[model samples]
Target chain A: MANGSTLLVGIAQGIQRPSALQRMLPSATRRVLNVQLTELEHHGLVSKTIFAELPPRVEYELTDLGRSLLPVIEVMEQWGNTHRTALEQALAGNLAELPN
Target chain B: MANGSTLLVGIAQGIQRPSALQRMLPSATRRVLNVQLTELEHHGLVSKTIFAELPPRVEYELTDLGRSLLPVIEVMEQWGNTHRTALEQALAGNLAELPN
Candidate 1:
């Protein structure tokens, strides 16, 4: 359920429909996606478009501000990939001490 | 508040402490980070380590499964950066029809 906005962005990249998003993510995650989308839309990071039709077709896409975040996201992803092993080790070391 | 896991990862990459995360993000987002960290630890995506001390100290890091996700996160970030303009245009188009 965490990083719902990124998931929404993932959905926008391809998922397209809310129903599809629900199916792709878990139930709790679906709720997170819904909330994130609302916030993203409110922030103008994303926008919803409805085309005229009997059912009223709708789609979500990123906005200018959102686009501006692309570089940052990309850097993060790159960093994640490059440092995966070290990060995992760090996490594992931390987990070893957690109480059951 | 959305994408809290990613934010947490960002924190782990450097933030190191909950307080640092709080200062880096908005208030609502700080709460989300706390929640996401808990879930991440529960799922073994992250682990916490406590050092022995009078006051004690803790740190969070990624796990093996979480490391596996690094490739995915990287791809998403690259995609975001590469497709920034197109995504923005798409989002802009969607926003055009939103009711006030």
Candidate 2:
């Protein structure tokens, strides 16, 4: 949740074309997603493929390295879900409500 | 890796007293580590305990949720080590020589 990159990488866990990704994360600007994709690509976590057609089609998918990150991300997501209440209390700056 | 919290969580995988953690991450300031520890505690991923002793010692350990994150963090560490070359090239801003 801290880094936008994880969200992008999570969405790209499965092979997806650019347009689909854009639609999936409508709130994110194309530029932001593009930057994350580039970073992931550079890190060898994601790969990009361009299809030759009337208009070039681009698809993004996780590499072995990228796929390796899913288990971690999944755990993070699970933790976030399981502890949503505590996290919300913390975020609200209500320290007193937190359990010991 | 982007968020300092992950690094902190990774370090907290095993029970560690503050002094031990400080030794493990010598470069990090005490304030920074404290902030991260607070965040993790708030999120319910970590728990803290105080011992009634001559020095009033304190210890920090991962909760079940925190321990659950180990598998994911392991994968991330593995991925980083495996793809160190591509990541380094990207960081160095050398676009060429990157495998396709």
Candidate 3:
């Protein structure tokens, strides 16, 4: 899910990378994120620059456009955390109503 | 996509319904939205009450929890509209770089 990766990157910037994503996301998803990062760089949403080393190293940072999305992601995080119980209850209720 | 439908309902609460969703979304999706609205009612994210009519009628309204999500969806809408060009460019560039 490219869209999922996009949203994840938007959430990951300036935050610790979640262990769940690292452990649970497929290798193909990691590759997709790499590609998306490159595209985001090309579109000025993120930046990639080389650093001095025997082998070149790079860092990914959000550009201004990318930074603008932080508020949106924060809102999503807040919503997820606050509504988590409600969501759980809803999910449970749905399951309970399911036919055997 | 239940999540997609949830997001769409969040977007549609205060705004007029978009024709694209009405027409392009599958009937199954519409049914899902109806179910979600009912669940949302149970969770107090939305409210539904009977209205006076020969055949029962109901109108949906967001409760406090639901209203809280509007800002998040607005941010997403803004991001989508503002980045539409970049997204298009990224998609087009990806296509152009594809091997023949």
Candidate 4:
């Protein structure tokens, strides 16, 4: 996943709790996810709800606009998965036999 | 298109000439397009060819890896077109009534 799309995809896939979201993205530090989540919120893609209960429960849910992104995310994920190997090579400029 | 994908898309749609690619993305200056084309070449997504002819013809073409990105670009463009209004607002953080 690129940009905050991974976090948005995580939120869409029933992982709304912050801790759960963090676990979903093991590579990103908690602080990074927090920052990205904040950006996602600022972008109107997701909404956070805070409860007044003890411990202050908080969860993220996709807004209407955010939900609209799911289809786009779906195709992106599919393409990435399908092209993962070539993509890795492409990013590294490792592929050979191109014209000079 | 995002992250130089517009240029890739332009090339995919048969607009291979540098001048035509610049025309396709009018928002970006010629120099900006050149920079992005360099980046794309660096990333192994595109290849440049120069013809040793009278006018020194040059063109950009997607490598096999780059052509694979077409589906991803298609969906991204679709989503952007569909959400252009909200996305514009979101970028400016001008969204109203987003959770306080």
Candidate 5:
């Protein structure tokens, strides 16, 4: 999955805390993930809450708009999975082996 | 919309020919569009047809799988449109002026 989609799915699936998200998407650089989260927050798709406690708790939750996009994302994911075989072959980038 | 989405929408909307696609998405480099089209075809989302004419003609049509994606694309587009205001503000990147 694309980084953005993965991040959104991670958040939607309850990896709202920053550290948890980092752990969930270990492949994604922390800086890149933070930027994507900020973009998501700025676009009003996700809401960020910061606690004033000593530890400074922070969490992210999908806004109504973000929730609404879940269906679309799900459909896209399904499509990707359904075509995974052909997509992988395509990504392999050796079309000479395609149907002769 | 992202380049991939735009290209898919263009093909879905009958801008099937390469030159026409170029015209429809003028900002997209011809090479990049070709690459995207090839990827779409590779993934089985689109089928290419080449007519054996004196000058040769090529066109693309969404496959059944691709057609199924229309709803997702439509929903995403609708979401983008609905959140255009906030999204534009987000893109502008000046959060200090946000609601106080």
Candidate 6:
């Protein structure tokens, strides 16, 4: 769920359409989103529903299992935001200290 | 914190020594453990102390941040245990249904 957390969390927040998810995760490739969605579906964390229309539409929603993961992911997201700078500096420092 | 969670949680459970952590995470390589430990250290999730002995002994202890991550990881671990079979079956089924 590392790479997939952003997608999953966005879906949990009611953004189900792929376009919306793509907008939210600009760095994510279509293939990557597909693969993450497939993994989430496989893990029972999310469900995919296809709508029959002039153009087919696909939407994703969190299953109960997926909902359960949200709080953890939320907490992790908060932690990441809170410590992102420190983590960046630490890694930079570590890299700088590495032997030539 | 995904891969590092195992090591962090193990340390939170009073398993501090590297050798002991390695024992707990048998599948983890020493390099992986070192990287995780360094990241955790950088994140302020854990701290390392070295004992000057016949051979230097290293130990890790969780910071408040690291301790906070434990509950989330514990919940995730429980969910994984609970849904292991369903998840495995789902993936296998998905794979089986794929076109040749």
Extract clashing residue pairs from model 5: none
Sorting all predicted structures by lDDT, with the top scorer first, yields 4, 6, 5, 2, 1, 3
Per-residue C-alpha lDDT of model 5 across residues A1-100, encoded as one tens digit per residue: 3666777888899989989988877887889789888878876678899999999999999978678778778877887787677667655654665676
Number of the top-ranking candidate, with TM-score as the measure: 6
**Candidate 6 lDDT, tens digit per residue, A1-100?**
5667887888988999988888887788988888888888877788999999869999999988778777767777877787677677767766787789
Error of 2 at A97 (Å): 4.2
TM-score of chain B of each: 0.76, 0.79, 0.58, 0.81, 0.86, 0.86
Docking quality tier of model 6: acceptable
Per-residue C-alpha lDDT of model 5 across residues B20-88, encoded as one tens digit per residue: 988877888999889888878876678899999979999999977678778778877887787787677
DockQ of each: 0.10, 0.39, 0.32, 0.47, 0.47, 0.47
Error of 5 at A39 (Å): 2.0
Whole-model Cα lDDT of every candidate shown, in order: 0.65, 0.67, 0.59, 0.83, 0.80, 0.81
Write one digit per residue (lDDT tens) for candidate 2, span B1-100: 3344454565565636877777666777888778777777766667789999999998887866666666666666776787687677655653675576
Of 3 and 6, the candidate ranking higher by DockQ: 6
Model 6 pairs in collision: none
Candidate 2 or 1, higher TM-score: 2
Judging by TM-score, tell me the better candidate of 3 and 6: 6
Give the runs in model 6 whose Cα sits over 4 Å from its true position: A52-54, A78-100, B1-3
The alpha-carbon deviation from the true structure for residue B13 of candidate 6, after best TM-score superposition, in angstroms, is 2.6
**Positional deviation of residue B31's Cα in model 6 after best superposition, in angstroms:** 1.8
Q: Per-residue lDDT tens digits of candidate 6, residues B47-78?
A: 89999997999989997767777876786787
lDDT of 3 at A74: 71
Docking class of 3: acceptable
- Candidate 1 regions with alpha-carbon error over 4 angstroms: A1-100, B1-5, B11-14
Off by over 4 Å in 5: A53-55, A89-100, B51-55, B92-100
Please provide the root mean square deviation of candidate 4 (C-alpha atoms, Å): 4.0
- TM-score-best of 2 and 5: 5
Query: TM-score for model 4?
Result: 0.77
